[model samples]
Target chain A: MSGKYKDVAYYPGCALEGTGHAYNRSTKEVGKALGLKITELKNWNCCGAMEVKNVDPKLQTYLSARNLSIAEEMGYKTVMAPCNGCYHNLKKAEYDLAHDQNSREVTDRLSRKAGHKTYEAGKVETIHALDWIKEEIGEEGLKARVKNSLNGLKIANYYGCMYTRPRHIFPEKDQGPGSESTSKPHFMDDLLAAAGAENVDYPLKTACCGGAHTLSDSDTSTKLVLNLLTTAEACGADVIATECPTCHTGLEMHQARAEKVFGRKTKVKILYFTQLLGMALGLSARKVGVQENFSDSMDLLRERGLY
Target chain B: MPIHEKSLIRPENLVTHEHLEIEGVDVSGHWSTFINTRAVSDYNEQMQEEIAALPGGEYIHRCWQCGSCTNACTVNAINPDFNPRYWIYLIRMGYESELLRDKDIIWQCVSCNKCTYACPRDVFPEGVMKATAHWLELKGHTEKKPSMVFDETFSEQVFATGKIEDGRVLREFFARTKQSLFQDWLIAMVRSLLMRLPVTLMMKLGLATVFHPRTRGWSKAQAAIDEYVHEREAAARKALRLDVQGAE
Candidate 1:
């Protein structure tokens, strides 16, 4: 742990504990391989995810604010959330707390009623896992540390929706030269490329996987995910590298759903970027919880001699 | 090609003549095409204000009809009829009857925010989509969508406990929506996952369903959010002109 983000607070949210368990496992494995320390936020609650926002946007704001308040109480200046939904909500809450007076009033009232320290804007800065890795360990550093490089692994880097959309919530992005672009995010690409993986020229990198309505509107999700899968295959990508749990799970489930119901089968494998990075750092596939994924990539990985 | 430019032209609106001669002009076959004149009445003047009263629809007045939202919408790409721009236009113009034509599919916005990102006027088209879906359910134009049911189910758990268990949310949503818990694809997915999962991990996951994870000392926060939700729901009902018993 020798970099700027050697140690930071980790808030996995609820998804990581269940459907996104693989992402949580691989993220920590990759962090260990890179000699970074991640401390979990103390007794954090839900960030209200996408569902609670539809109920009431202010309640969602307060939910995320409660987690940030916990982070601030632990004397941490920076907190890292790997789930895009969690990261986006935290950033949105931070923005609303700073700009919207009504949001401030609601969060203040809720915090007082909840008997927790009210979280003021700027008390803690939220960073995504992409930002944490890209900033803490530069691409050059990753190149130097690769024990078993991801050679011959062609990947289509998928950033999905929440990572960069409705740009007002994320003020840190789109800063001139090396910052992440909202239209064309490249943090995952940069990190994977540094690991010696061949990134395809994927145009739908920022496309939606329709994670929000995967169950409510299954056909639409299947069609949208079919587009992503077929497009990735057309781009000659064997694997679609994902950074968000919801997108990863959506792609995996819809891949199966497309086959089961729609009779349209696509053979593109889905794996989290952290899992791929962990394997590149010489961690075994089993070590990164690859088998725990709904999308089985073990055969392809074994054929490529990665594990 | 993005479906906004020509989406207003419906198949029923087009009239074609198989064999016709208009003043010896021989206007027949493909050339004999005329769009029926449309007269839109029964405008609900309070439609825009009602939607604006929702939580995410505060910026509906900022739209300037640039069509950026439709061009960048995710669902619009899959199904052209899911046009945010046209819906926003109808909402602003108080064409409630015309809006009701596509009421069934309006709840499928997916919340991708591509529309919000592309909007130059900062209208927050994503929020507007949610508000419209909400308005549809509140005003009784359509039955409650699966998305709404899922949101309500998920939110109820969040309000009860500060945290949500995914298993519980899934079960309750399926039960409430009258969907079976054992769909073939879901079973297959779970089977495949269990095939690879270790024994310890399986036990942990199984126990989670029983224990049901929750946040400590969450009663106060739950009470506060419950009160706030009740107040907001009342306000929304008032805006939509619904009575205390939910009758309009």
Candidate 2:
């Protein structure tokens, strides 16, 4: 593993501070356990998630660019975002600023008016939590650090939509063997497998949980998330490990919605990959914020003697 | 030219003779089913251009009738009526009336980007979906959808303050949509979380609701974004020709 990402800027975004607090907690805990350094982006604003783009895509671009400019000012070459929405938006802003003249113009104008340094494309590279872990601490490194290996845990790693969709934004992925594949992402799976978990062949790995409209259009989000949960169960997965906070929350919210509204009960647990990895590295469930998850995996973790 | 697909044709336009001979050829029942021909004269000549003028719809002219967007569509997979390819075809053809038939469901697009990923022509069907939804509301073809209401609520917070508290966004969205926040599933979700969440964490989340998180020195950025949004909104209204009508 390269030492380039040992210490990098972190952008937790809005979700991390709110509904995805567990993800934030576990991510930081896992980093600490792995001996990796993390420096949070100071006074960062929202990355617009999936909402701002609906109002106007350029506004969304400028919003993310603001965060990238902060990273540049902080002197970090690499910025790691734990939330897929934040990660995708930053990557998209980078792509648009570099490729589209109009995007660059609008962003520069907004930056000038907003009284911040305009974020030029290629100034700072943005990476997802999966890439941060997979690249920084390779699977071999994870295997060596596992104190309580996830030996018997059956996991279905759910990459969700934003991580690898509209593949154009992510130029680094899909480059032959060692690089991540956009169509069939395996960074989370690779990391978990190294932690001794059995990775299932979950087909809906990159499927949309309808996270964008999770609250607005509840029924569709419910159906989409139900499909993910049921498929994970069908694949014999005890837990659906997620890297995106939106997908994680969507899966958990819609799991309950499906049972109440559709009367279709599913038993698969939803856990952040960081939480799972944190536990494998000997962090207690409490330390990884496992209890903060909406899905109660205490019984399963207890039965598997994970803690 | 109107599409002649069996599913695209309205049932009312399908004519069939139960037991009759056409020109003495014994054409009856299923064999005699004929699609009633109707002249389409209400085409909104500017429909395609209007949609293209909106953000994300810029590449609408590049589509070549490919079904890849529809094939890879996440919404279309669940509900066959949510077809991006068909919608693009209608918009390009200026088939305004036909497009209106599916106006309500268009906003239900999850913005999943599967269509964008699969579109061979770089039409960015996902963006086209968002643009069409906006166009529908701007033209008053449909009421503000729940998704649009959610977007406005979420964006307003971002524009006002550089950050948003999730609890506030959720509460405001439900209130604007006239939904009771005490839904069974939502209550169950919160209850499950409260069962194990530490008191400190709960206090932190509760405090965030009272004191909404804001980016320090964000007023300048907020003002800039507001100006840009107003400009975009006015441009969209003009493109849809709604400005001339004095309708919102």
Candidate 3:
């Protein structure tokens, strides 16, 4: 890799492995173009995500630590995650290892409960994908290579929670120097700007798009989604862009309820940042998984001759 | 114009105009790129690769905007706009301006664990919100009214002395908030004479401070603590960047 990043170890957590595969595929395609080699980790398992904690708080961190331990065993120092759930879990494990000694003890107990080894203090570094683009690629280089540029694309940047909330527990510094050090502060924003897209900051950027809420309370989830969509639409966003697969599914697929519940209507296209970046990179619609989304992002793609 | 009556834009008009904020500076207009946004697509491949390298970013590609987290949150009941689901989606999409303006809602979370509990896929939406809030806490202190007022003085005091004495913190807070001098004086006098003198006299008379050893080498202790935190933060940042870069 001629760019700043030489090689990378890619960890596509469970969500991406099964449901969120589009992110994995598109990311690989895009990464290759950027002069980075993505090597998938072997025997990578579920991140023990945020759910197990509620079900069994005792086993929670241990389950997450197992994933980290796997990375440590593989001799991988750094791992990247596409799902906010995976990011949060991995980040939490890292946080526990660093500051909370009790957390280590708890996870160690779980390690014995599950019969897995205890994760050492400061075992491995876990992070979201956004920080990588800003730190390694460097804005100037990334922007310099833009091909099609999705300029004039009125976009709403969706954060979907796990990337940048609860500062005390966050794993990384956000928005430092030219680097957007923090989480979800536009892992795609910088790329969008580099690609010539008009990224509009909607007040609802941090607004929950109701990722997991759909299962337990569909209507409430729908209400939250509608409010965010309504606010984003009000902000003049023609398209809503996001990183989390669950958030993407919620925001785009649920537009009908969002329209009905809020008594508001919008034709705002919702697409993954990868899809948008693929558009910018001049990838054909099919190659970038445009049809995968419920929204007719194809229309947006076709309008730009991206299809 | 007849006697002017401000007409609030109805829901119907929201589609025609949209509000956008950059660096906390909000603006609204017809959904059009005010700046030459042509830079967006030029390097998607490179950024895509960079984004791809992060471990969890793979799901970013799968994100379909299902409103699960917003519905899962108890905090959203109080403020209808606190959406973790949307924020992560935006971050994956590279919307920096939206994230910057998001400092308001990031703080609304009570961390009740409902959203995390409700998430079907175990997408811990709260973690990223915390990360973003931490990001803001660093520089966002200058932007936030509450943090700006006294976070600095409080931190300086704590950094100088290991713990925050409530009296000291409150006094600095009151000063920063610009409370009237007489009001503060009255409260301070009442509290000091009524609640504090006994405690203070005991300490002064060496009855209370039996174990309160004078914090000798406090600066050295402070430096060591600061250095350790800085190192941990640095390590975390390094790992985060590595993950981000490699995922692509």
Candidate 4:
């Protein structure tokens, strides 16, 4: 294995175990197909996932810090999370621990009480799956490895909130060349383009799916997801390439909700970028867990000869 | 504090008389508008400080009234009444009554962070919205919002098990919110999934529901989190001047 992200610590968080099972399966399958290694974080807990912060931001920090601490304990400097919520929380915890003394003290106190070593900032670096694929194997590497190209598929790469927001949390992004942009992310686009798919110009690429209130405020989530779906369809995207599980499920759920409740039916398919990349890498739909997804793209896949 | 004059153009504050002559000039229709005047005195002096005391609302004091937050807000795009800039202005000026006008929609911020991203003052307006929502609920201005209920439900599971099963959380949230499990769209979504799902994978998922996934040796962490949550809740209640029972 390459000494880089070929073998990094993986933190799937809670979503992957349930609704985001497709993402979990596709991410692993793509990693395996590309000859990368993923060492799952040993007994990793939730990374707070946008809900704990409402109760207490410091507690959310502690929750993510515990996961980072485990990676540190396991001797891996880089811990990778595929879920935007997990990735954002880990990065936010790292930032808060370094900059805010209160957060540090609270995390330390909680760690001591929990009988585990406190996670110090700078002990480990948090990266998203986008960075894992982009940095480890560039577009050139990806292009060379594509066995079954996505010849006619059109994609709208959607990078939801939490991946890049509040700006300060993601310090590494927005740097000059070779770094991801917070305002207009293109890593997913770049990766998909290399796999022989056409990417449409989607304005709402960084729009919120209202994943935070998917269940809490169903109507609001439906509206937000409806806008994303219709906008993607308008952009001539056959599929919305997603990097976050919450976003994937949010779109899928709300698409149905919009049709059933709001009477606003949209035809844009939603699939994880890994699932798309996995298919481009010659893996079957079932192999990448497409059936596990709430949004069925089987007919589309078969029509495009991808299934 | 300077008296806040009711705007002459405001529909609620304006009074119009039809078919009446003003000074015998026959200014009877459009020119007959007059604003109702009132002295502004009832202000919650501790409103800003109380909101600032909440976790996400800490940096609200840094705001300079730039409309960037509202302009870039996600909810604002849909509902014109959901204005963050106006709400922040009200909070900072201790215009409690004015803020209450939109108390119900404050919790609908969606945490999009567009406000945070657009704010040049680093006010973290997204956090301020959450804090304001919490403040509204604590002050008895509004009930616990569905979003807060969802957050508590999701957090409780995480604190208890060090993990959460989305299906269980969804079921519990729907139950708490008095929503039916068999919504048409939800059933349609499930039907689509079930059609393509393999039997073995379905079996595995069923077994997962039976034996919920949990982190091993998570008891100590769970205990620590529960204690921290309890202390945090008490502290938050204290900040909002609520009793231990969350009553003011």
Judging by lDDT against the true structure, name the best candidate: 2
lDDT of 3 by residue, B53-159 (tens): 33222233444457677886766685666777776665655555445555665744544455555556645555444444544543333244443234345444434
Ten-residue stretch with the least lDDT total in model 2 chain B? B1-10
DockQ of 4: 0.79
Clash pairs detected, candidate 1:
none
Using TM-score as the yardstick, the better of models 2 and 3 is 2
| Local distance difference test scores for all models | 0.90, 0.92, 0.57, 0.90
Tens digit per residue, CA lDDT, model 4, A202-307: 9998999999999888899999999999899989999999999999999999999998999988888889999999999999998998878888788999999899
lDDT of 2 by residue, B1-248 (tens): 56433343778888888888758788688866888766677778899999999998999999998799999989999999999999998898898888998998999999889989998899999999999999998888898999888888999999999998898999999999899999999999899888888999899988999999999999999999988988888888888777744644
Name the regions of candidate 3 deviating beyond 4 angstroms. A1-5, A112-117, A174-176, A179-184, A259-265, B1-248
Second chain alone, TM-score for each candidate: 0.86, 0.88, 0.49, 0.88
CAPRI tier of model 4: medium
In CAPRI terms, where does candidate 2 land?
A: high
Residue pairs in steric clash, candidate 2? none
Between candidates 2 and 3, which one is better according to lDDT?
Answer: 2
lDDT of 2: 0.92
Candidate 4 interface RMSD after superposing interface residues:
1.0
Model with the higher DockQ, candidate 2 or 4: 2
Residues B116-220, candidate 1: write the lDDT tens digits: 899999999889989999999888889999999889888888888778888888899899999999988899889898888899998988998999888989999
Off by over 4 Å in 1: B1-37, B245-248
User: What digit string (tens of lDDT, one per residue) describes model 1 on residues A214-276?
Assistant: 888888998999999999999999999999988999999999988899888889999999999
lDDT of 2 at A121: 97
Better of 1 and 3 by DockQ: 1
Best of the candidates, DockQ: 2
